[model samples]
Target: MSTAAERTTSPQPMNPDEEAFLRALGRVMTLLPRAIDADMMRDRQMPLSEYTALMNLSEAPGRQMRMNELATACMLSLSGMTRVVTRLESRGLAERVKCDEDARGLNAVLTDAGLARLREAWPAHLASVRRHVMDHLEGADLAAFTAVLNRFPL
Candidate 1:
């Protein structure tokens, strides 16, 4: 039922500047996962998922996290966390234990070797984080970005 003039009365199309901003954000998103995977593999001798799980454990108060919490933080499944913990256990980096609060729950605790490895890998990871994401932004830009990201739909 709409004609050309009616369509013209609708809201304006996206401005070119807005389009360019979208394109740049797309490129940034595309670079992140690949770059993280590459850098973690090269410098840490670990895959991204494993590295993320270890990082979460390292940052925990006691270098331990419930497997369910780890799964949620790492955006993985419980079964997937089991496999990752199994791999870390095989390498003497971490182990699973009965949760003190919940008899049926499990916790992944980082071993001494795992903590050492996290320390060793921290510099490279921090450098990459700085170079790729933080180095380019000023405080205002970062704040604005944080606000915008907060507004996004989960």
Candidate 2:
């Protein structure tokens, strides 16, 4: 067990520019997802995660991927991926198939209906993305921004 003094450490103070940058990053992180998710739900009748899952599966070979791979690609927990898959299945948009190479594994497959739904939502999704993000990036120094972003370990 440690006392308060032992458990506490002073944080290095950030300069004003650093502080402003961090605050702006925080606001963007918070607002971006909410805006995208709200637009998707309102227009697509599905949340962003489900759309992401569909999009990922649509791009995969055979329009299918192992559950673990799908989960990783979607940046979702296994259970969260499972729930999203279940919801898609209920909507006849996706199905789970037993992996041919690994009986213990399952694959998520995009159905024709899923593709159609994706097509239906594509316009709105693209428009929303353009409005919220791509528009802001237009004619900007993307190479520099990309390089800076790539410097981060994430």
Most accurate candidate by TM-score: 2
| C-alpha lDDT (0 to 100) for residue 66 of candidate 1 | 95
Off by over 4 Å in 2: 1-12
How much lDDT does candidate 1 score? 0.86
Prediction RMSDs, each to the true structure: 5.4, 5.0
Clashing pairs in 2: none
Worst 10-residue lDDT window, candidate 1: 136-145
The TM-score between candidate 2 and the true structure equals: 0.86
Q: Tens digit of lDDT per residue, candidate 1, span 1-154? A: 6788988898557799999999998998888867877887898787777878889999998999999999998878999989988999999989999999989998999999988877787777887777777777846577777898999875
Give the number of colliding residue pairs in candidate 1. 0
How many clashing pairs per prediction, in order? Answer: 0, 0
